[model samples]
Each structure stands twice: as C-alpha cells, then as structure tokens.
Target: MKTITTAVAALFALSTAVAADEVCMNASEMQSSLIDWYGERPVEGPSANNTRLWVSDATGSWTLVRTTDEGKACVAAQGRNWNASMDASDVLSEIAENTES
Candidate 1:
C-alpha cells in the first residue's frame, strides 16, 4: 500500500513538472512572422531598445515582446521572471550565454 502511494505521488509530481515549461508563442521562421501579438505597448522614453513588456495588471503575469532593428518582433518569455525594480544582469548574462542562435 505504501509503495503504491509513493509511485502515484511520483507520477503526479512528474506530470505537473512537465506541464510547467513555457514555450514561445510567437515563433519566427522568417523575419516577417514576428509581428507583435499584443500590439503596440507603451515605453518609458524615446530611443528605447525596441523592447515592450506586457505585465498583467491582475495576475502579475508578464510577457516580454522585443522588436529587433530588422522589424522582427517576438515574445521573448512569459513568467514572473522579470521586473524594472532591479538589475537582472547576471540572469540575463546566463541566459544569453546559454541560448543557441
């Protein structure tokens, strides 16, 4: 009985963990398909880095939408993994270093 309970719990945990991974919704094969899904978001000032982040007012959910100088836009990520409150240089560096072009 104990063995069966443990097995069931393990399976449940594995399933939940697998479902938590987030995939980019606005995938780009060619450059043109990368238009902003949420439309034009506001910015702080002029000459910003073509980056628009949409943070949900209710859920604290967030999505980063960045447009390259080539006019290609894509959702970089969606999670509680960002904020304008602090510097995320280390996290950003680790991600940049690990990602493959």
Candidate 2:
C-alpha cells in the first residue's frame, strides 16, 4: 500500500510538471498574435492616438498598441487587468490559435 501511494504521488508530480510545460503559446505565436491584434498600430507606448493592449503570462508580458484613439478608448473602456507574472501574450496566442483552429 505504501509503495502504491508513493507511485501515485510520483505520477501526480510528473503530470503536474508536464501540464506546466504545456501551459501555452510559443514565442513566435505570441508575437504573431500581438501583431494581428494590434493591426496597423505601432507597437510602443499608450499614446492618445494609440491604444495599448497589455498582457501578462508565466514568462513575461507584452503590449499591443492600436493606431486610432477610438480603438484605444475602446480597450480602455473594457478595463482589462494586465498584471500576471507569466507570459499572458503566450496564453492569449494559444487561446486564439485554439479557438480559430
């Protein structure tokens, strides 16, 4: 019984590690998604004429800027919370890919 429990524990740990590793998006996918989402906007600061969409994930964070003030205003109105340690860009990219495909 003790041996079975130990085996189960080890299996659980391995599964958890695998899940973490597969959490989501690769770098290129992330960059692509951001580019698609931002459209024609220049990726930089959140200016009055540019809307900034910021995202975070397990690895890091990224921002997508929109060229038109109207777009910026729309995102600002939505009030998304962009405060995660991981790479949210990757997560979003993964989600987009999954949903689209």
For model 2, residues 1-101, the per-residue Cα lDDT tens digits are 46544433332232211222332344344446655763222223544534344443322233433344232222211112233322333333332343342
Clashes of 1: 0
Local distance difference test, candidate 1: 0.37
Tell me each candidate's RMSD, in Å, in order.
Answer: 12.6, 16.2
Candidate 1 lDDT over residue span 15-99, tens digit each: 2111235333332532222224322223222125554544433333344455666655555544543333422333333333433
The reply for model 2, stretches above 4 Å from the true place, is 1-32, 35-47, 69-101
Task: State TM-scores per candidate.
Answer: 0.33, 0.22
Q: Which residue runs of candidate 1 sit more than 4 Å off their true CA positions?
A: 1-48, 80-101
**What lDDT does each candidate get?**
0.37, 0.35
Angstrom error at residue 10, model 1: 25
